[model samples]
Target: MLVTGCAGFIGFHTARRLLTEGYQVIGYDNLNDYYDQTLKQDRLHLLTTNPSFHFVKGSLENIELLQHLFTTYKPKIVLHLAAQAGVRYSIENPHAYVQSNITGFMHLIECCQLFNVQHLLYASSSSVYGGNDKIPFCTTDRVDQPISVYAATKRSNELFAYTYSHLHHLRATGLRFFTVYGPWGRPDMALYTFANSILKDEPISLYNNGKMERDFTYIDDVVESIYRLMKKGHLQTRNTLHEIHNIGSNSPVQIEYIVQLIERELNKKAHKRYTPIQPGDVKRTYANLQTLIQAIQYQPTTSIEEGVRHFITWYKQYHNILD
Candidate 1:
């Protein structure tokens, strides 16, 4: 099993779960200071303690390195989760998206073809839904339009997966993840940032004046969904060689509600500042889980309250912040 971005939020959890389930996992991550490399290193630490885990520190941008890893390991299942992730950051550095998401993804998939990798499970984003006002975004909906460069690059990944699946018969599954949050999450995410700032008496930026809503999927649910899909793809006959599904909480919550939850968990009143919605950001993102439900019988069970509390607990402990 090859898990790219193993130091990242989703990838870390996914790799850990797979390792616990008795799989020899190859964990690859650039350990970029996108947020804090210490957090990434810590996540990698947990996995490295296991004898079956092998860690590689490198970027997906290096095609030769990716090709060499693919050839050497020849991973049967490549979980491509590494990417320059951030909607706001994409606005500032469009070239980074093109390099990491577009160019890096192409090299990764080409290596998959060369290695004859059986199943390719890569990460897509709910942001691909773009500016559609439709409630609970559906996988069947057309995604020709993208509001952000980050989203555009993810959509491109799906297209690449489809082409690869069609041409090479590589079983590819592109998971469109909704707003995922939990322990060990990226610091830039709303939940973490809000909690961190609130705990430190720093003002929290409420975008769209706290009107934005998101389907905040928990990390455990996401990992379980990924594990099930990977196992099924590995075991089952090639009935569906090319497929896409939305991995989300399946429950939409307002931005204010999440803030309230975090504030309550930390027992601190947030210093909130209302702000205009940033470009390349959607006002709302809700997932239609009918497709995911039917495919894997998967349903996200974590509530906002429980997820928030769990995250707060971990955050305080990780940072050694006493209430």
Candidate 2:
């Protein structure tokens, strides 16, 4: 099994789970400074302790390196998760998104085809359902419009994967993840940022007057879904092996409510600054997880409060914060 972005939050958790399941896991990560390198290194350190796990540090854009890794490992299953993430950051550096998400992703798919991978699963985002006021975004919904370059690249990935599946007989699955959060989450994400701000008694930025809603799926749930999907692989349809599933909690929570939950978990009140919605930001994201449920019997069991508490516990321990 090969997992890209293995040093990242979702990638780390998935790799650890695979290792525990007794699979020989090869992790690839660039260890970029998009977030804290220390955190990425910490996750990598934990994985290296497991004998079943091996890691390679390199960017996905490095086509030669990616092909070399694929040729050497000959992994049957490839989980492509590495990308230049963050919708807001895409506005500041659009070229990075194209390089990592577009060019890098193409390299991954090409290698998957060359290696004859049994299954290729890549991460997509709910952000692809841009400007759609629909309550719960479904897989069947048309996603032709993307508000951010980051989302556009993800959508492009799906298209490219489809082409590969149709032409090369590659089994491919694109998972449209909602707002996933838990321990060791990304710093730029709202949950982490809110927790850090509340802990420091600093003002937290509330976009769109805190009217945004997100389907905050727990990390464990997301990893479990991925594991199950990986095991099941992809089914052929119309002579093409391609599938798209939305992995989310199927329940959306308001941004303000999440802030309140964090405050309650920390026994404190947050200093908040309500502001207009930023560019490349969406107002709401609700996922229709019926496909995942019907296909794999998957259901997210963690509530927002419980998930937030778990994250808070980890945050305190990881940061050595004493109340």
TM per prediction: 0.98, 0.98
Pairs that clash in candidate 1: none
Error (Å) of candidate 1 at residue 129 is: 0.5
lDDT of model 1 at residue 25?
Answer: 93
Candidate 2 residues 1-323, lDDT tens each?
99999999999999999999999999999999998999999999999999999899999989999889988889999999999999989989999999999999999999999888999999999999998877799999999999999999999999999999889989998999999999999998999999889888899999999898899999999999998888777454555478899989989999999999999988999999999999988898999988888778878889999999999999999999887
What CA RMSD would you report for each candidate?
1.1, 1.1
Candidate 1 per-residue lDDT, tens place, 1-323, comes to: 89999999999999989888999899888888878888888999998999999998889889888888877887888899999999999999999999999998998999999899988999999999999877879999999899999999999999999898888888999999998999999989988889879878999888898898899999999998998888778665566898899999878899998889888888889999999998988998889989788878888999889999999999999999988
**Which candidate gets the maximum lDDT versus the true structure?**
2
| Model 2, runs deviating above 4 Å | 234-240
* Worst-scoring 10-residue span by lDDT in model 1: 231-240
